[model samples]
Target: MAPIQFQVGEKYFTANTKTLTEGSAWFKSLFSGSDKLVLKEDGTIFIDRDGDLFAIVLRYLRSQKVPVFYNKIYGHNHLLYDQLLTEARFYQISYLVYYLENRFYAGYVASVKVEILGLDHGVDVPLPDRDDDTDVQYYPQWCRKEVYVCPRRVAVHRGNPGGCGRECRAAQGDRPLEYEDEWVLKTTEIRTQTILKHNMDSVKP
Candidate 1:
């Protein structure tokens, strides 16, 4: 049977489904001469220097396609991922939110101190438990869209936030720090209480 053909438009340029043939021309137009996407073995795609993969992801998101990719290469970290996901939710990208929720539920990434050791460690935190208490001391705070590490510790080993960006080394010289114990994920109960308090405070007599 012949396939259905739909008129190409700017919207098609951002389509992310596997069945992306009808709008090939329009999709090609969105890309600059130097812009290109490379598929990785992990099922993620990388864009050229001039092309922002986030835009592609957003396009797919608009088309209801799930976009899953971590952009914390050099110094970016899970905090950035969380922040991005938050923005994704704010913009009403259910697909991206679903993807982020899965990552959070499946524990594809680690919290902060507890590295992605395995599925067991990932399950330890649990999705609902994330909002309990954020252990900022060790895990670094994910507030205000930036990962701020303490300037008193050092990244003696890999993934350690020592001297890569912040000055959290000299602040804690040679002190065997216990960042792991500070895993403070927020709890649902606390969140509910805070919300209720805010509502009451905003109420007029």
Candidate 2:
């Protein structure tokens, strides 16, 4: 296979499509003779990633393992770590992504210093855990349809004979982070608390 030139993160990189296709479903589908993706003037692809992360990806493709260079970098930089995770997921390199996320989440848990108040009652100090399936059956949804369309508007009666239920849409939600689903994947088995994560680096000192 010819090397496909790509401009990721506005940097140019030449990569073998065959190696990429083997690792990523996204790559296989994109380059599988489908004309949906447009090529560059130089007959290459233009992906929206910066050339930086792809460099690590290329190294992984060559070695078939997470790059050694990634360890210390994620240890010191949270922002870049998140960025690398996004790139890894986009490329569908589950092995690389799994390790990166485990590293990041481990760092996050070790550094978690926030004080959480007991929100056993339905108050906002710590927010209630809305994930319980019972909440959807007992409460009225606090919704303003004019703002946006939410799927919670519909209700289904599940696991009860002659029982009816309505959806509950509370404004304050405690859903997992964007990468949390990846973390919760049974194959990845990323052990973590259900609380949302935050980075101190994001706050101005």
Q: Weakest 10 consecutive residues, lDDT, candidate 1?
A: 193-202
In the range 1-205, model 2's lDDT, one tens digit per residue, is: 6787777767887888888887766778888876657677877677777688888777677656443322321334567767878987888777667767776344333332223222212333332344411121122233221222233422242222223223322421464211111111111111212222332231111
Count backbone overlaps in model 2: 4
Candidate 2 matches the true fold with a TM-score of 0.44
User: Best by lDDT, which number?
Assistant: 2
TM-score of each predicted structure versus truth: 0.21, 0.44
- Give the C-alpha miss distance for residue 166 in model 1, angstroms: 74
State model 2's lDDT. 0.52
